[model samples]
Target: MTILDLPAAEAIRFAVPASRWDDAYAAGMSEAELLLYRSNLLGSDLTVTNFGGGNTSAKIMETDPLTGEAVPVLWVKGSGGDIGSMKLDGFATLYQDKLLGLEGHYAGDQDDDKMVGFLPHCTFNLNGRAASIDTPLHSLLPHRHIDHVHPDAIIALAASSNGEAVTREIWGDEIGWLPWKRPGFTLGIMIRDFARANPQAKGAMLAGHGIICWADTAKDCYEQTVRLISQAAEYLNTRLAGQPAFGGAAISPLTGRAAIASSLMPRLRGLMPNADNASRRKVGHFADDAETLEFVCSHDFSRLAALGTSCPDHFLRTKIAPLVLDPARLDDDTYLAQSLEDYRALYAAYYQRCKRANSPAMRDANPVVVLVPGVGRFTFAGDKATARIAGEFYLNAINVMRGAEAIGDYVALDEQEAFDIEYWLLEEAKLQRMPAPRPMVGRIALVTGGAGGIGAATAARMLREGACVMLADRDAAAVEEVRAGFARQFGKDVVRAVACDVTDEAQVSEAFAACSREFGGLDMLVANAGIASSAPIEQTTLELWNRNYDVLAQGYFLTAKHAWPLLKAMKEQGGTSVVFIGSKNAVAAAAGASAYASAKAAANHLARCLALEGAPEGIRVNVVNPDAVIRGSRIWDGDWRRERAASNGIDPGEELEAHYRNRSLLKRDVLPEDIAEAAYWLASDASAKSTGNMINVDAGNVQAFTR
Candidate 1:
């Protein structure tokens, strides 16, 4: 048999001996817990499984705590649970007999949605954890352990035109193959009948979907899955011998990289009209990585680009086909706009042609992944992780298709079959499992002092929760690095960066201008840029006070003054917010730090006055007073760390953080995320009515209390 080589697989085998599975069976941990453990092993590897790509289950007996009666239950992955970090509660426990009984009644009508809706009611757990749509299929399977995954290697064969012939060539009768079908009531019935027909087979492959492997033990089933996929990988490696990546498809961008970043990314964000002059859903973020670049730049791009996705799960994630940008028109905004319009029209037509009664409205017509010839494949999503999932999946898919093309023609389910799965209620239900977006979603935020500490953390946090962010800092390289990294992860529209000396009025104006140009306007302004450690009065020079006050005092003033118009305009949608990153020093002066203390104190008063002026314009101003947030903070970077360490009688590197950790009444180490969470809540609607206040985030600093 082939060997398991995935990193997650290796880690599991190392941590749990081969006998661990047997030990678990004897230990009396519920089957749900066992499945949860194994599911995490598989879900940890993106190469084998993505965010919600695969599921696991086992049938077992659980004794009722009250009656002491043994009962049969089917434990399946819940609808919205991530396999990697899933717990016992993440699995839905259903009465085995009731779950299996549903198969007999399903006539396959609008019942698809009804069946999913009724799953929670059937769940044995009273907490309302919903079962996945594939619960019935898992219940009907006779095997003790079952796993279903959309592995990249398996997808190459399953999606290929010659998959059946190739699958048989590789495994012969070891694995049975099924025609492309949306997973539901009828599909569950097929799995049952298929298993009965081939009692000796190891598992089954779901064409245009994924693979399933089953065995008496979780370890045995997992091993079999690895062996089967490894065999496929070996076959693929042989076929890829002579072909070069990006061989036939590569062409230069019509313009240069600088031009693309400066002009192309923004133009793509514009409102492009359809043939009827109606604009569709605006695209969100753009994502690209090294692998995505290779595929889009390959010479064989056209032939591969025309093919559909390797599996149907991606029809929900990436859609059927990514809109390929015209290579020659990369520099022309008008041509790009016209092309996007055409792309929307084509998608609308595709939906109309195949949509059945009760079909969900066609997903926004804009493409998720856009391939620019010279630039790379750009994945647009509502968030970074989704964008990465689509980009990563497609990049892997290209290799799978290359393998298939080497052996035979790469094929996918027909348009009708793909449409059926895309519109299926079971597939649509998965989205409901996602955590509700934060209140700041669809809003724009500009954060100053974003290079490190609270500023960087807040920018990332806001972007993750669904707000577009613009990061401003005088550290040019740091700002760009954060900007570029976040842009790649969250899409270009999701994050922007400007190297602005916040104390400079011109740079502040330019920062706001850039913010408006990218995201239209801003709803939240976090004036967090400041430096520390001014000399005491006796030793202080004119320069020390000016430098300290310029950043802590004037920086806050300039950012607020320049951002007011945009903040006021935010009233059309909702009230805007200004969160100043003040310090505990504002309320309590530290001796030998007159300039620093006085500067922050001035900034603190500025916030209160700004609140009075901004209240009339619906611009709520607030401040977060925090002390000593060390990690990822430049504030503790240089001479100050060594001096503080010496004063504490500890090593500079080892105990610098510990020295301050004890100063708080709570004795907790304040980190950047703590400050960020405070800023996030203030910027969100949670503090909509309560503004013009200062929140002390110092973990109980009574020295500055009651100020």
Candidate 2:
């Protein structure tokens, strides 16, 4: 049989992480540069460390700005920075001597919360990057260069019931072990004392935490860290041979898991509670890979998940525990709703049981991670990046659990300790210090004709305000180029592209489905795809009339008709919106454009009718009309510009825009950006109460004004 057909336990294997150091690359580098190179290499492997879950430090001599004398400085990864993607500026620099001197101010373990306040006072070189709480853990360690990372294999050993005994069995005197302690001044001191007493030891494992290794040179330190993790992984793999992980699988995975996830995501998102428009809404991500499916379908899944995660990093991201659901009953709405309520109630009780008088108020109690027995996992957070990262963190937890159970019983952290870390006052301050979220932070939008000028501009405005957008256009290459540019400017997680001809009903349906799959649901729809034809009534053939209707009229109908269900599902998220990009010709008649004007008029009326039907459900529909957006419009690059200019007795090449501008009552030029601004307002909550209305962006053309 093929490897894919084997059970997960039988297919499990662990490969040691190899060193990626290059002597030629590190030959002429300074101490700080070597530290960065080492950090990037170690963080490159997930088996070495998860994202933003570790810190590395180097004590180096640098010329003091104040005294012009060389002083020893400690450079470590700053708060909220991921080592995998960090640059030199990402490190927080502090005076090494000043950090060590703080040992005298330590009034004991109770002062851990206050000790963080003094880190800024020890800042070296006026670096503004904030030091993380783990600074003490690295600074107090008696070594010139140190690496502390949360590798899954090492954590599996650290989190097992017999962690100390197993650690001694594997490394003997080379590695030492310490009992569980929250990272702080005391833990650092404990590690320092342990290292001094056992100078022969290279590193120590902090029980239920992670491993640390040290050396005199940067290369030695990096190689030692890699060696210890590789050794632990090899030991685990040997012990796990012929042993079923998590007591073997209880249920086999079902087929078509993606389809199931897509079907359930919208309903799940709708059931979540949102306080108001000011509060950030949740965006969802789904994963159904083989590894995830194996754990979710295991026999011990329910029990182990209840125990929660051991590492502080894992616990903070995945929450105290995940909400588990039965795969068989997934189709039952009552069951799903009740399970969510049960999970929230238990979380509240946990908070009330463990809360101190000064503990931060309970945050949202909804589960960030959810497990389906026969499927995989679903994670939700305030944005796409966070949601996706949270999923990655949980996968690390899964690997830790699998390794721990393969050798011995996996031990979770104490409830009191978990609560203390989760509700730490220092962490609360960091949260409060974060910048306020933008207005469209968790919104998802889909724009038709996104390769064209107006659609692309509207999409950019939405993205700048923090919305995820899906660009659907018939010109696949042009749309992809736009998606790439936006992805670079915003982020890869927030923008996507799909080729679509709006006139085709099947393609339109699939486009909306793709949006739902990429993001949980749609919050806004911009029906902006269009075509133009300018011919006298007698000269307008049946083919021309049909082509105009197929795009401007039928295309809008198909897009809106498909967007209705997803928008209705997301109504609780500050209400949903549909902004139709109409034209001045829709309301004001022009001599030679009978077919184009009439089709646009049909689209305008469609918005009003939709508004009447959707008002009861909190869905708003509106229109934006433009008179002469000739600068970047795709329609103006062809026969339409010449036709209009010929009818108006002007040069089509140079005088077209000016002729249309002077004819307007306001005598001003109308541009694509002007139309985009109107569209943004109509879709945002600023215009929430006003729907079934038309906003004319025609430079004050009296004939086109709404009456």
Candidate 3:
């Protein structure tokens, strides 16, 4: 098949509307926002093609007192955030001169220490965020826009058996392939120095990581990225298409069919929990496909585990590789046990071979893409976006290897070269500078329970923080009324309301899709729409259990599933964060609310698993478990309060006061605003380091009970 027939190649060319630029630029985006938008766009481009395995940047005019009024500023992508939803704050700004100075100060005595001092002079500090490690190189570039993307097709060529020769033939003059150096100022300086020597060169290829392309305009830069990858894809495709092929054969039996599948399925499901059984089956089948078996048998399946990333940034998604599975040789427990040892050995070898004399050791060695011998191939990522990226890289690598086999042999970058690029000092410095951005800005957020109380409060909170929000609820009139009121308060564009039933999957999907289409993409999700029905465990019938699950667990699952692609796309652009509005009952069980408690607990677990699975993709997932957000909620109405008071056998006012006073350590009722504040933090860059964590805004309710 031609390179165009390859999935990675096809995925890479997925067109983003040129109109997006017009929309973004016309939106009067701030300099910071523009930087963020461009960075994210580059990331999205790379992820769709390579799968969360690239970096991007932009250069803007900054006030330069030395130059009198205007000098170019370099705004490069940060380390911790996802490219898909990167905001203006996501790009670290550096003065051109300051970056150039970084190279001159790299003394042999203290590289890291010196690098830390250089960070503050840059414009990145203006926005109160850290700078990217690639800041120096990006600043050194003459171009206005730069994108360092690791297209799977290109990396396949870079890592091929004959990669060096193939690359030389295709890009001898226009592209420069540097011997691998650890990423940071050192690597940046290397590239900068090389580019200085070769004034005409447009970009460079880091032996193992990927390629860097720069140009005078965003379009030119993007075109260059596409051109180089397309050429590489075409070359590999043509080379492979001419080779002799083996017929399909059962090289190995599908052993440990149930056990291996079961163990792996949960992890996969965690990444895509709502994927139908059919989709899950497809992934499982592919893992044990004929090609996987053949590939496993052909290689030193044991030794192949040592390969480093297809590129460095891929670490954000793939996290090294898949666990190896060999059913015939070992039982379930034994197989699981051996996986860690295999991973460690592979990691050790890659580190030892790749580490520079004085640099820190490599962090992970297990291949993000795995071969399971008789089982098949598996790509491990926290989410589908990352999985898809790993899958693309693996497919391209396979094609490249096959082609190299035809051409005599594969020619991967030398071990030393790989190490150098991976540990490039300049690159590491950039990583230390920038912090992650808040999640909701530049995103469309939907709060399902938004018409009243918590949802309305969340909508206002997200809007104030720069998100376009859609408030959704089952009460159509209430939604409309709130929409008008919020529009009047926050301006017409900031908030909208949609009538929705959280229990209906079709409705939830449609609402989310509409929101994404209307406001670019959905980034922050608060699944707060729920009912709190109180009943003893004996009175909780099957219908009650099903009803609670429908709105609580199933609703979250469906909303997340439908929004996954968009969120993944946004994350690939930069980063996306999710906040699930859970209740204290999720962790602190109660006597009367069995169905509610069970569903909430399940939702909490789902959030944790999602956080683990989404991390590699740069999507942060967390839960805000709050207790008794009393003000403005339906439960606080006159009739409802009277009934609740009657049940508790007290005066209505006294019972209400007693409930709030008794439940919390602070002896105060939790306000919707308080919960909103917690949600805001979980959805922002402030919580980038935290995930799979539960933040309690319960006025110490849980703490009081526990104590």
Which candidate has the top score in TM-score? 2
Ranking by lDDT: 2, 1, 3
- Which parts of model 2 have CA positions greater than 4 angstroms off? 1-9, 241-244, 275-278
Compose the digit string of candidate 1's lDDT tens values, residues 1-707: 11222121100000111212355453665556667767877777665666777888888887755568887877888876788778888888887877767755577644665666556756764646778777766887878898888777788788878888889999999998998777766667788889999998888888877788799876776667667777877776665654454343344333344334334544454433222212111223333444555566556666678766767666667787888886557767578778778888898999999999988877767777777766666665544446556767676677566666656777756888778877776666665555666555556789999887789899988888778888999999998998898888877757878899988899998888777655546678999998887454887888988999899999999999988877775453446789999988899878767888899999999999999999988899998998878788887797556645654678877477776777789999888999999998888778989687888888878887844
How high is the lDDT of residue 549 in model 3?
Answer: 91
How does model 2 fare in lDDT? 0.88
lDDT per residue (tens digit) for residues 549-667 in model 3:
98889988887776666566544344667889998888887667788888998998899889888888878889898887767886456454664456566776756767866768888
Local error of candidate 2 at 145, Å? Answer: 0.4
- The number of clashing residue pairs in model 1 is 11
Candidate 1 at 607: error in angstroms? 14
Worst 10 residues of 2 by lDDT: 1-10
- Counting clashing residue pairs in each candidate, in order, gives 11, 0, 59
RMSD of each: 10.0, 2.7, 12.7
What is the C-alpha lDDT profile of model 2 across 270-307, one tens digit per residue?
A: 66775333346778888987778778877778899999
Off by over 4 Å in 3: 1-38, 47-53, 56-60, 65-68, 79-83, 97-129, 141-144, 168-172, 176-179, 184-201, 242-259, 264-310, 315-323, 329-331, 345-408, 411-707
Could you tell me every candidate's TM-score relative to the true structure? Answer: 0.68, 0.95, 0.51
